[model samples]
Target: MENKHPYSELGYKIFFKIKPFLKKILRIKVVGVENIPLEGGCIIAANHRSHFDPPVINIVSPRPVIFLAKKELFEVPVLGWFIKKAGTIPVRRDSRDTAVIKKSISLLKEGFVIGIFPEGSRARPGEFRKPQPGVGYLIEKAKVPVIPVLIEGTDKVLPVNSKFPKLFKYNIDVIVGKPIKFEGISSYEHIAEKVMHEIRKLKGERHG
Candidate 1:
């Protein structure tokens, strides 16, 4: 198999090394780490509320995650370089790009974890955006377990229009639900709905 995400190895290693500091700073509380399989390809579908969502999820995830980042992020000077080295896939929002889909499926088949925010972009804090069909398509084609993750407090950490992230003041919780499998479920939109439903359930539990 070709190593498309070559920087993942080094990038993840660095993340692991700094995890302690991040934990101390962010007060990240992660639940359901055991739900993630020890190996194999899987999809992690999470809600997006802040730009910090990706790194927060990445740090807590047991394996290196190949996230589908916005294409513009790859054009950023230093940040782009870092994300690319971290093996994030660049995607054009609101565009019908088959190449991105094919690459995701292929990566899943190769047993790499793919991280996705089905909302397609960050949602306003305390707001819910319906999951798009792209994630459903990937789940249907990959034939792998789909992990539903709910991240709370990131929106406050670095809210929309905020230039800097507030540190050491919020408790970020990452709740990873059981892996959901769909069989004979053909509707991509339906699959995306089911995934969001699970995420909402996680949200309920957090407050309940």
Candidate 2:
């Protein structure tokens, strides 16, 4: 695997050491660290339970992840600095940013793990919906492996719009399924649905 992300060269100690303690302090248990590949670039499609999802994923995994986040997140000053330094790319939610797409492809080609949340929105409790097509776009364009990750009990741990996180112990389950591969998808949407199905299977019936 080649290093495509600029942050790929940076150390993982900060994210690795901090996440587990934070999770333990906050009581977020990770069960699938072994599921994440130790090397090479692959697309990790995880269920979005909260704003905490990205940080949680990075904290638990030993390998560095280059996340494709929405452009709006870049506005926060200190956070924006760290994300930029982390080899994260921002995409405009409303319009297609050719530059963002190109950069994602380049990073994938360079063998950096890129994460795409297929839901395209935050997770809602008692409900699961079809995934958005952006994930397929990346998979098809990059021709990489798609790792299906199921995030359970995250919504309960940190529900959307809670204002602040609770200190109570809550289980955050991460179930990683087998990688999915596609050959010459007719379109990006097709690739996305195919990937979403694999994720759905892994995410069946979330329990806290």
Give each model's whole-structure lDDT: 0.87, 0.74
Give each prediction's root-mean-square deviation over alpha carbons: 2.1, 3.5
Residue-wise C-alpha lDDT for candidate 2, range 1-208, written one tens digit per residue = 7754477354455666576677777665555556677777778888776766776677666777888888887887777878877778888889767787788888877778888788888868745567767667667777777787777777877788775666576766776767787876687888878877777787564433
lDDT per residue as tens, model 1, 86-167: 8888898868678998988888888888999999988888787989998888788788999999999999999988878999
**In model 2, which regions exceed 4 Å deviation?**
1-5, 8-11, 204-208
TM for candidate 1 is 0.93
Q: Candidate 1, residue 100: CA error in Å?
A: 0.8
- Relative to the unseen true structure, what is the Cα RMSD of model 1? 2.1
**What's the lDDT for candidate 1?**
0.87
Clash count list over all predictions: 0, 0
